[model samples]
Target: MVTKLPLAVLLSASMLLSGCTVVDLDENGQPILPKDPAAKASFSSQTPQQIAQENWDSRVLKGAQDRALTWNDMKNKSTALKAETSSSVFVKATGTVTAVSDDAERERLLTVTINGESVPVAIGPVIRSNAIRDAAGFKFEEFTNQVQFARLTKALNQQNVQQLPKIDGSWVGKPVQLTLAVTLQPQRIEDAVAVVIKQEQP
Candidate 1:
């Protein structure tokens, strides 16, 4: 008769014999997977759900602030390119609200004139882009799998829209200051998602 060990026992023994460490400790407790040294650390331990549980309050805000540039500087192509990571960047701009999209639209946006350029800030019931996620400095390469990364990006976008206070006609014609996270494919400024909007200080 042949004897068989439980699946769990076999797996544990395999890991022990392989001498594989689950995480490298310096990383914030995410499990090691799909090791790629050419880029930043990648992990497999944490699921999109686990990371998304905290919502927009996670490190995204600080990351955006720390890596942002003034609107004037970012408007220059070379400067913006240098600031980009994974083809996105964070920009801090002070602008006058030039126009606000109709509330009836499912995808609403606030058009702000930053240095005389009309830039659309999506204050959304529906946000359709990955600008916020890309601008926060996270690259797609850092994720172990595409499905999880896509799910995480979707969760991040939802959290982003949810984090905003209500937008209304009252906000039009107001001067606002914001650190905007944008993608850099043609106009997006960042890949790591971070956005902070505040009334401009006089």
Candidate 2:
């Protein structure tokens, strides 16, 4: 049967179709949010763990494979490398482990020698650098907020550390091959391994 519809109802449906949110207001003219969420309630998250899952394969490992600078190139010719690099870079290093810091596992550091350059690599229970995050080449301005940016940093660090093999004093003299994320104008011995992809030890 043909029936006439209210103009208001038609207009409301049109507004909804146009992506306008249907918010309810209270007496004071403020939004009256829902008490219990509905089935379609949604939230967005890119936590460290989630981030790790998304980027670990295509971005972290693969990207490192494509964009990494040799340890010697990163250390000896950094200025020239920086001039050519317009974004984040990975430093690939392979060397024998010389020492391991006994600090909290999160704060642990492993010393390795690559191309005669001895440096500390942080394999964290707590990573203190933004190596992987920055190496992803994301711009800070594009982040919705500092909190999101921090989440990305945590995510990258988590992704990298998850790939690390177990380590201890026994690992000394074992050959380790890893990738690190470092800035063009690095100050510290460069942040440690973004990931330990190969460990030549039993």
Candidate 3:
């Protein structure tokens, strides 16, 4: 005669046969599974752009206070003050447009003076630095080359010029505010080769 197994034994045997572990359930009956080690590893290895994007709202926006610096302060105190004041290499400066370059190259330059020091802002047809990508939290590595960079910058430049039509000429001598992405090697700050310029409303 065949004998029936106990309900507990039957359940245990079924679980063992299926190689399944008991899943803990929440009060609402949702199964809770262990976090995947691979996913955790992948998250930890996220790219700079990804990390920057994730922290953009908190770190770049709300956490860090805007520090207004003169061009001289930027030239002299960029390294020291940046470390003490903010986590980002980006900064905001207000000044009069003392000069603007007439170069028709993909990269255009604008010079502004604050406290008699000149700061240059580059608007691009060819954006070379990763400054904007880092500052704006873009996935630049996905583009990977000059052609892609050129395409992206061209599109950006077209859109920006529409808003500030005469960025090179009309904006000169006007009091303006700029949010720039700075680079220490050559020691320059620019418009991130995009729409980083704003004319102070009268």
TM-score of each: 0.67, 0.66, 0.47
Q: For model 2, what is the alpha-carbon lDDT of residue 153?
A: 79
Clashing pairs in 2: 48-155, 106-125, 106-126
Q: Number of backbone collisions per candidate, in order?
A: 20, 3, 1
**TM-score between candidate 3 and the true structure:** 0.47
Give the alpha carbon lDDT tens digit for every residue of 53-170 in model 3. 4545454443223533344565664455443243224566677887776757766778787656676666654456555334443343444444554454334334444444356677
User: How far off is residue 148 in model 2, in Å?
Assistant: 0.6
CA RMSD of all predictions: 10.4, 10.9, 9.1
Q: For model 3, name the residue pairs that clash.
A: 106-125
| Candidate with more favorable, higher lDDT: 1 or 3 | 1
Shift in Å, residue 47, candidate 2: 3.8
Residue lDDT tens for model 1, 1-202 = 9999999999999999899655554467665575556664354667775665553455577767677877666656434354334355677878888887888997788888788877888777777777766666566676777887777777777777777767778888899888777666434433323266777666
Give the CA lDDT, 0 to 100, for residue 55 in model 3: 48
Q: Rank the candidates by lDDT, best first.
A: 2, 1, 3
Off by over 4 Å in 3: 1-77, 81-88, 137-166, 185-195
RMSD of 1: 10.4
